[model samples]
Target: MDAGGEEAKQERHLVLAHKLFLLSHPDLDDLAKVALRSDALDAVKSDGMAPLFESLAAAGVLEPDDALLAEMRARIDEEVRKLDEKIADAEENLGESEVREAHLAKSLYFMRVGEKEKALEQLKVTEGKTVAVGQKMDLVFYTLQIGLFYMDFDLISKSIDKAKNLFEEGGDWERKNRLKVYEGLYFMATRNFKKAASLFLDSISTFTTYELFPYDTFVFYTVITSIITLDRVSLKQKVVDAPEILAVIGKVPHLSEFLNSLYNCQYKSFFVAFSGMTEQIKLDRYLQPHFRYYMREVRTVVYSQFLESYKSVTMEAMAAAFGVTVDFIDQELSRFIAAGKLHCKIDKVAGVLETNRPDARNAFYQATIKQGDFLLNRIQKLSRVIDL
Candidate 1:
């Protein structure tokens, strides 16, 4: 081949090889690397991590640092440590809730790598403790952080219940409102419209004091703070928008349900200027909180009503879902008889009570919708336990 043609061919081959490298690795390929570097400086700005700054400089995202960088990192670390102490103190007052979950959730990326047992341990510790207002809130926030960071569903649900409980009990309005953001994250994690909308409204109402508050209720403050740091970069490429990130927030399987809960909390954040219409008048101010409370009740009742079905589904699965005594479920079965909601019989042949209802010949749906409603009412007052 001619020299010129050979050179051109070599360039094309190199480009093709690079493309192939990206395609071969499904996760964290070249494109992701580029995107990650682009966002690195933002992390430094947003989170002010000495490690992140040092890492970014190493990655060529920013210029090498000097003593000033060390000083900055030190200051940031001190501030971060103080925040951590505040969280710890708040939880200690309630029974060291933050510590209960400290090991449970380290960070998002770590959790995605998979650590369900640690996260679950945090849940047990928190459950064993008692919490008052400040400490209770601290514990709730710790739970929120671990739940969102690690995407732990049980933690998310329990924390949501705790936050709403404190809010209803007249906990610090601002903090409770902040927890609404965490609550929104849970809904967002789940993609449940009703909960997300309510959480968003709660976040909006509490914005005036969000800055003064340092807690996990506002899960994405880190991301927001990160992006703002990237603002000074002399680069503008419509690579992705905020909404796009938020959209992707809901689909990450491990984080989906948790994200739905968060979405339910922040999808309608009014504190950011809703519509800018002078006379439009906000609807959520009165309607949203009350409605959220109503939904919470309904869900609890529905869960209770499904107790029989749940036991039949899988003992292990039900235990994971409800976060309460399986024995309690068994104990509650007798209650169903009084309500005319449960019936048991011996099937002489297969020798099983058949709660799953798989028997074709002697099978029946036994419980009427009315009986379901009766049982549902028993657990209907769950508003104080879960937000939505």
Candidate 2:
């Protein structure tokens, strides 16, 4: 073969090798090296491999050397500028390749700087384009990624539905797992802890079985949802006792402390630990929505435990112990009492909350009445059946 042909063949081999390595390996350092080498060999101005480099840079896999990163960014910007010119010049049909590359460049840059809305806006440019199957899939994934990064649950749901329609036969396992993760996140955002926990556990199983890199995230969410839902046994079984989860939990001290306090039933300690990490928790996009509700649920558990331990406690003492105003305690207790969640009576004049246990006689009478109602309903159903 001619020298030019041989060099082209070599470039193709390198790009293919790099893509294969990314598919199999989860090591960022190794992937960075492959991406750099591939970019060096394919030294074209508007290289198609820009997306691959963009992915690595966004993931922080590239070297932290500022000079190198700056150069990379400059080149990407130049390429995108050229693509914009080409798009503007085309009258009828914008070339698919040029449009996709421009979209990817702008979206990646916006995402790197945490401008999720701009990233999403860039993605929308290609929404109505006539693209190949692979590009269509990329658009779907990018839409979902931007939606998730910004905690846009509505957009996330729409993207998932679009993905389902685009790949109706269920696509690959990786895509299915990604959809499951988003579904779980939606449930988490909506405060449906039980359903969220179940979906996260399923995603964790899929990730573990596939040896995926992001199973840790699913594990963390599973534990968080389980805790809020008061399913400590499941949390222990699915997270605390699992070796994989244990390994990852050590990396997040806040989570570890929260779990420890929960397991030990140190309600005050748990709140203290959580309060200390409030700023950090608020910064997490996925966890922010659940913060206020989870705190309220934890407080409920603490109050219920306190009530169980005392026949009658002064509202002032309870408020002081919980570090809240007496009025606040009164309001919360009133809510619980009205909802029938707490079997207690508040004596406003005495400023005491008196615990009430079900009397055996009253319980027996209620059970008898319930059984009679059930029998009457069954007889009515049988009478209707006979007439039919």
Candidate 3:
């Protein structure tokens, strides 16, 4: 065999071994291209070439000797499509959670595709215990495909909830980042810039901290789209100035579209800042002070912000966000209303206080309540002054 044909044979050999990438990974294409090269294939031993061979086979670029490997991939892909169709049918016929069959089939496919470890952690162990082997979220191997479909269809809200449930049920950071990207997507869709920023920051922090690959760029795409969507100059400026945020944007081809709307060329100061303070300034600035503060303080700060924001918040948004039966939120809200800590009478609900002072007892709770109870736990403590 000539050199090129020999290299192609080697690639096919690797593919037959089930060690190749089954699909193109947009995130690691640069690193991945090296593995796809004939030179790279020639450098590796037979065992070491497995992943590369798998990629070549999946790409259909390998030699044709590995009919068995091609057959296996075809079978796996067929089962994946069947499971996807089953999921769609289950959703149409039955109600929620009826698609466990599809999850199981996809789970097996994922396992066969060399994503078994990723599948194992994502498999719903508790649910799997109740159901037999062939169906469960944990058993679903085609999650990544489903996830991408959800993203493509712009069903961000439903997608986020489903992915999050999967994550909380013990899906690893790989799945979590998928949900995080969706969360950012939700904010982007709703035009809620700040929430998008927070979601993106959280995604970057978690993905970087975990050292996971391929997904880091995905979440950043969500953030970039969000920034461009934002009408506010501050939002655009903040993200563009941030280098961790900028690198992903720089990598993507969509930068030119934003230039007319965002004049990013003028920001030389941000560019200088990017080179200088990047290590200290993370993708976001919000989390640093808290990590410096006591852990308990973070929850308190969040709750305080929530309560402050709650005063002017309408029952509608609160109900949707907390995902409660509406009556529950409304009922509890009445209690907060009665206590005077929350004033619901304002004509506006889009904005509210960011914090509350705990020192002044009379600012709220003018209404009399029975003393010696937890009625005003959030109410400011009273100060006593006696002339001696």
- The candidate maximizing TM-score is 2
Tell me how candidate 2 scores on lDDT. Answer: 0.63
Question: Which window of 10 residues has the lowest lDDT sum in candidate 3?
Answer: 281-290
Q: Candidate 2: where is the Cα deviation over 4 Å?
A: 1-81, 84-138, 149-151, 165-168, 205-220, 305-341, 346-388
- Top lDDT hit: 2
lDDT of each: 0.43, 0.63, 0.43
The runs of at least 3 residues in candidate 1 whose Cα sits more than 4 Å from the true structure, single-residue gaps closed, are: 1-29, 35-131, 208-388
**lDDT (C-alpha) at residue 170 in model 3:** 64
Check candidate 2 and list the clashing pairs. none
Q: Compared to the true structure, candidate 3 yields what TM-score?
A: 0.32
The whole-model C-alpha lDDT of candidate 3 against the native structure comes to 0.43
lDDT of 3 by residue, 1-388 (tens): 1224333433232233222232232333555555554443453232233333465656665543365455555666676678779877976897555665555555554544544344444345324433432233323323433333223334335545555565555656555554554456445445454676667766654543111123434444444444434444655554545555555554433342333223333233323432332322222222222222222322232223345434345545555554454566556555555555443442334422222335356734543444525545534343222321
Per residue, candidate 2 scores C-alpha lDDT tens digits across 12-55 of: 32234334334334333665666654554343223433444455
